[model samples]
Target: MKCISWNVNGIRAVLKKDFVEILYALDADIFCIQETKAQPDQIEVDCELYPYQYINSAQKKGYSGTMIFCKEEPLSIRYGMNMEEHDTEGRVITLEYPEYYVVTVYTPNSGDGLKRLDYRMEWDKAFSAYLKSLDKPVMACGDFNVANEEIDIKNPKTNHKNAGFTDEERNSFKENLLAYFVDTYRSLYPEKVEYSWWSYRFKAREKNAGWRIDYWLVSPELKDKIVDAKILTDIYGSDHCPVQLDIEV
Candidate 1:
């Protein structure tokens, strides 16, 4: 199956761009989106290919949210981590199939000056535990909001203390998620340099100054099934481009 994950930044905004066109072009079996910034009622995707569409909107309007579009109906669907504090943001959505569970997450950003760093740390622990509790193998994807290693981000020296590149967040990601799951792209191509996200300022995308924050991570047992993982940098319409995963599952 082919699965694609992208942080659209805002669903409504991307819809005005190439969202629908890209959806048709990629033709993924499952398409996961993050940072929807819209309510369930507000999202109007015109694609007829995906009859099963699920959205997890935040309590606050036009805020962090996630959505998934699948051609086949899942056996079950779950929203959030079942933790009230974290669920309010509509950051997580899990779809359980017969073979495996597919989870899409919009991890909280630490915020300017790292004001929410403490809460982010707490979220990491809870999110990790939630994934571990799943009964079947998992294929989790989305904008994790953290660049795992120096190689994952451009100019690591200048971004050391930044929100997504901070040492604390990196360490937490390693201990929390990487310990249990395999990062598909990095696992397949350790030395490959590619990025999924780029700053909107200073022509960062044009200069190729970007960070590989978005990912497709799977359970260790599913690691060998990973056929191909890619960062579709050529695609546009959002600050973060789409990441694709091809697997037999």
Candidate 2:
């Protein structure tokens, strides 16, 4: 199956920028998006290509949210981490298939000056624990918000202490992998230095100064099933590009 995950930044905005055109070009079996910033009722998406749709929008209007469009109907769908503190943000959505689970998340950013670092750490631990508790093969993808290693981000030396590259956040990511998941992209291309999200300032995308903050992490057991992992840097609707995973389901 071909699964693609992207942080569209804002669904309503992307719709005006040939989002549907890009969607048709990719033709993925499942399309997962983060940072939707709109409730389903508030917007209209002609996602007729995909019969099944699931959305989790934040309680606050025009905020963090996630949506999943799939050709395959899942056996069940779940929202959030089953924790009130985490669920309120509408950051997570899980779809259970007969073979595995597909989860999309919009992980909270640490914010400028690392203001929310503490909360981010708490979220990482809780979210990772929740994934582990699934006890089934999982494909978790979204804007993870943390660059796992130096190679995953440009200007790593200067950005080490930055929100997304902080030591605390990186370690939380590592700890999660140590438990039950594998960063599918890194597993396939350990030395690659590509990125998924780029800053909109200073011509970052033009200069190719970006960070591979988005990811497709699969349970260890699904590692061998991975056929390809990719970062679609060419597609442009949002500052964040899409990441894809092709696995034998």
Candidate 3:
């Protein structure tokens, strides 16, 4: 099966940009979107065919949010981890299938100047614990918001102090993924420098000043089932591109 994840930046804007066309182009069996930034009533898309959908929206209006659309019904659905500190942002959603748990997450950014670095770390720890507790096999995908390694970012030296490239944040990211799952992209195409996210200003996208902060991570047991994990770096309707994983589900 094919699963794709994208952070549309803002659902309303991308909708007008013909996100539905992009969605059709992808033709993924399942699609998860981050930063939807819209309540269901705010924006409408053709739903007769791609009808299976689940949304976890932030309590605050027009802020962080996520949604998943699938080809078929899920065995069960969960909105979040049920942690007050984590659920409020509406950054997580899990859909259980007969095979494994498919989770889509939008991790919190540490913010510029390290203002929220401490908070981000707390969130990282909690999120890691939650994933580990799943125990069952998992295929977790999303905008992690952290460039895990020097190879994951465009200019590592320049971005060292940036919110997503800090050493501390990278370490936390490693501890989390290394604990159980592997970054499928790195495992399959380690030397590739393609990126999924770029800044709107400063010609970041044009110059390829981007970061591979988005990912598809799978449990060790399912590692061999992964066929490919890639970034659709050229699809530019949003600041972030779509990332995907082809797995033997």
Which candidate should be chosen as best, given TM-score against the real structure? 1
Which run of 10 residues does model 2 get worst, by summed lDDT? 172-181
Q: Model 2 over residues 1-249: C-alpha lDDT tens digits? A: 999999999999999999988888899999999999998797677867788889999999999999999998999999999999889888999999988999999999999999999999999999988998885799999999999889999899999889999999999888865457889999999998899989999999999999999999998889999999999999999999999999998
Q: What is the TM-score of each candidate against the true structure?
A: 0.99, 0.98, 0.97
Where does candidate 1 stray beyond 4 Å? none
For model 3, residues 9-58, the per-residue Cα lDDT tens digits are 98889988878888888889989999999886775777444789888888
- TM-score for candidate 3, please give it: 0.97
Looking at candidate 2, what is the lDDT of residue 144?
A: 93
- Judged by whole-model lDDT over C-alpha atoms, candidate 3 comes out at 0.89
Question: Which segments of model 2 are wrong by more than 4 Å?
Answer: none
List lDDT for all candidates, in order: 0.96, 0.92, 0.89
Q: Model 1, residue 101: what's the lDDT?
A: 99
Question: If both were scored by lDDT, which would come out higher, candidate 1 or candidate 3?
Answer: 1
Which ten residues in a row are the worst by lDDT in model 3?
40-49
